[model samples]
Target: MDTECMHINATLAKSGYDIRVFGVGHYCFNLIHATAIFCLLLSLSSAVGVIILLCKSRTGKSFMTWHKHERFLLYRCICDISYGFVHTLDHAHILITKDHVGPSGLCALYALLIVNTCLSEGLFSLTSALNAFLSVYFRKNVNFGNKDWKLLLLLGIGPFLIAVLVCSLGVLGPNGFFCAFDSVKGVIANAVMSTGMTSAILVALFTFYVLTWYRIYTETKKLKTQLSNNGCARSATLKSAKAMCLFVVVYIIQWTPLSIYGTWQLISDVPFGLFLAVVIMTNLSGVFSGTICLFNKSNKISVSNKDLGERTGHERKS
Candidate 1:
């Protein structure tokens, strides 16, 4: 009876039941796993759905269309697909035991995570760059000939350089996980990367706000000019402005919390699972943004019209 009791205790210890049940680790792991899975599913569905919708739309004249910001939406969808694939790997690595995982698997997992991080940073930086470019591009006071290309280059390069530094310095620890530093080194390295990412996010948010204000100003001026001349153009201008504002607001809300949590995790000693959960949540921001874009009444109406046109064309040909 004692022998059986000892055997059970040893089994429990080895299985991590004792370690998991007594602390927050188990719950954290479960939460991370669940969130990651959800993110992966959401991203995949959103990406595929957007691709299909884009293909069916007559207004999608090219892969990088200027109409309705189709190019930006396509870029975001691609990023979402890549992010989903990386998080799937992250989820597998976290949920499965190391004993059951191979070295190749570990490397692939780490590589994917780093790549996703880089891409996320890059896309975010591009969003900021786009905002800056629009501000300069549309400004009445700013001369096109005098526009600062150097500043644009600097803005574009900043996040990428930071991403490169983070990836380069993020050493793989003895435990096979890539982190900021191995010990103290790892902590410092992580802090640097986290700080860089946080700074980039803040800059992006600022740029978005600036662009929103610029749009509002431009639209208000246009509205006034058109109204002074005639009222015929009022409805179209208002619709365009309303749509632009809606897009900006939805994006900011979806991405802001994730940025805040990421910045917090950089300075604090957060648990591994908790950190993973936060990252997963950040990835899910794409889902929310995609949902808003896909389900907006105007977008839905456009998609429906496109679908009907395609169906009519097919039936006529048949």
Candidate 2:
């Protein structure tokens, strides 16, 4: 969506600028972001609360002893906070200042921030799927022997470095309610890099999740054969499967719309309804992740039945 460039004669305007909101009057503009701020705050609060719930669920356990499942949720919490804080601040700034023009370099920085967090979250999710695979097939979370630091570096620092390149085509400018990639360079960059990367991640997610489900099915069958109480075993296992199903459903829904639609947006104007759907879905992911975490600790079952526990984080790689 090519929003009217706030700076008509600015260098960024020549290249084309896109703000966060579009095709709206001042009143509608304020309404959208005012609502955005509220939702982002809700998501932010949920993420923080989930962290507390996680810590509380392990009240008797050692604080330093991070389990596989707990670790994923913790990573998600940090990402949520990073995104929620920055996004909310951007929206709030616009509302307070009633100015669409962002600070000199803030827009590109914000765009970079968006890419980094997204990449990190996708990586973490892939790691979780790998954890599930290992737990179901090999009966363990990944063991790096003594080179655990390598895994840490990949998860912790890799996204930041990668984002520098992924968003390299992006330039700073007012993008509606917030600052982000300018239109000419930004749109093309997003269409290629963002779509390609997102498609790759989605494909990976689909493959791992399918394998995980197959493993669960086989495990359920094994339990039915070994245990006298076959009904109980199947029921327990299905409950675990249900949790994993939640992640699969939400992930596809969350990512699919934008990735597919973004390419079309390169050629024609983005439909307002589609854009709004993307925003609402994108903003609520933090809420979904945090909500899952809060329930996970309480709903977790024994690893003997559920490789993917309610933590769905698969804490029970047990």
Candidate 3:
């Protein structure tokens, strides 16, 4: 796809089409396609696991008793599956054609799906962090309840609408072996939109997590003051704090590279490593986010089930 686009651009330029090459050459899958295949497998398996785990009802609990974090996981898994499907189809086409040029319309379709995937992932990542923030800030009262739809609208619907608009407006087109905006304005617009959105989400996550940690710190200090030697309680609080820190840390490490890649496109003459970083990081995002959410969700469900069992046992004893 990229090889064809480069030829088209070169031909257009010779014919005075005023196309400035964003960067030289097309996207090479030789080095990264295997990694991408692995990501697809990992994402699909994780998504399946999360879906199965999320559906099980524990005894007599109402549907409303579902955790807000579960909603985030559900959305994340859905997006991962969609994203993985789109990516797999695109790469499969390329591999089958031996990296030959595909139809522009098909390439546009690919671009649209890719944008949707990226935007949805970004929004949901933000939503996940926001969920954690609410969990910390509201403690036992963090239920969105009636406002859950509003949250869904902002995180899911909004991003999808924006992606559709971008696609319809032709802000995305064929790039190389994949689809992206080729024109200078299109490239700039895409860079700004992609980088700006992801960076904003990351910033929000950092801000919320920092505030959450501060709250944890204040509560821990208060506990120490009130109880003087609540050693076990303090230890548990510290562990929770560490867990929160780890969540934020993993989110940053997984997401920052893609944001960097988006921003780097605006500059000329970047190193090959930066391009490699972008491809690898962006492709592996499914693996990272899916695995992390699955791991966390499994642990949360296990804990909930254990608590439920203990309560049932106590009731029986009574």
Using TM-score as the yardstick, the better of models 2 and 3 is: 2
Looking at model 3, report the run of 10 residues with the lowest lDDT sum: 304-313
* Model 2 spans > 4 angstroms off: 1-12, 16-21, 24-28, 64-66, 138-140, 144-151, 166-173, 227-249, 294-298, 302-318
Per-residue accuracy of model 1 over 154-225 as CA lDDT, tens digit each = 434554455455446544221222211233234454444444555565567557667656765666676765
- Which parts of model 3 are misplaced by more than 4 Å? 1-28, 56-63, 99-101, 134-147, 183-185, 224-250, 293-318
Worst 10 residues of 2 by lDDT: 305-314
TM-score of each: 0.60, 0.77, 0.72
Residue 3 alpha-carbon offset, candidate 2, angstroms: 9.1
Candidate 3 lDDT tens digits, 1-318: 233223343443321124423223435455445556666667677676667666774336554445444555566667778877888776666555555235667767777777877776766555555544554565322233364676666757777787788877766664544565544336556666767777877888788778877876776676665643343334343334334344455567767876776666556444557665666666655466556655664555322211211122223344
* Cα-based RMSD of candidate 2: 5.2
Error of model 2, residue 138, in angstroms: 4.9
TM-score ranking from best candidate downward? 2, 3, 1
Q: Top lDDT: which candidate number?
A: 2
Candidate 2: residue pairs that collide:
18-175, 19-175, 19-176, 20-175, 20-176
Model 2, 1-318: lDDT tens digits are: 334412233454444443233434544565567777888898888888878877887788764355445655666778888888888887787777666545546766776787677777777677666666655656554653333455567666898887777556445345554655555456555555557777787888888888878878876776755644444444454554445444554566778777766766657776656666666667666787776664665676333322333232233332
| Reference-based lDDT, residue 140, model 3 | 29
Candidate 3 clashing pairs, residues 3+ apart or interchain? 2-176, 2-177
TM-score of candidate 2 relative to the true fold: 0.77
